[model samples]
Target: MLEATIPVKHKVGLHARPASLFVQTAAKFSSAIKVKNLSANGNFVDAKSIIMVLTLGVMKDHEIVIQTEGADADAALAALKSLIESNFGES
Candidate 1:
């Protein structure tokens, strides 16, 4: 398994369209992806699960823990980190 901690840089945080983009990105990987909000009191959810993501209520500056496992875990994680670093490329 691979893991990393990512910070939300988007002004509106990970919600709505951003979350949808994330979902799409996650689906590209064959590995299992998961996201956990520690600052939100240890709430964790499957990255592919939009409902779980919305439940976390992620906010700007909040920290999310990303983890994955499978054949493409490394590549998937790098891509995911890049996406997070770019704030989902939304304005």
Candidate 2:
């Protein structure tokens, strides 16, 4: 498994459009991906599920840990880390 912690920089965090983009990105990979809201001391949730991700209540400046496993784990981790680091394109 591969994992990384990143802080969300989007003004709205992972809500609405950002959340959708995140889920969409995760869906592109076949690897299993999970995200935990470290800022909220939250549990891991399905990265590919909009509902599960939304439930994370990830606000701006919140730190999240992304974990991925399976054949594309490295790629999946990189993609997700890039997404968040890019502020979900909200910048």
Question: Which one is best on lDDT?
Answer: 2
lDDT of 2: 0.92
- lDDT per residue for candidate 2 within 29-61, as digits (tens), equals 999999999989779999999999999999999
Q: Judge candidate 1 against the unseen true structure and give its global Cα lDDT, from 0 to 1.
A: 0.86
Estimate the TM-score for candidate 1. 0.92
Runs off by more than 4 Å, candidate 1: none
In model 2, the runs with Cα more than 4 Å from the true position are none
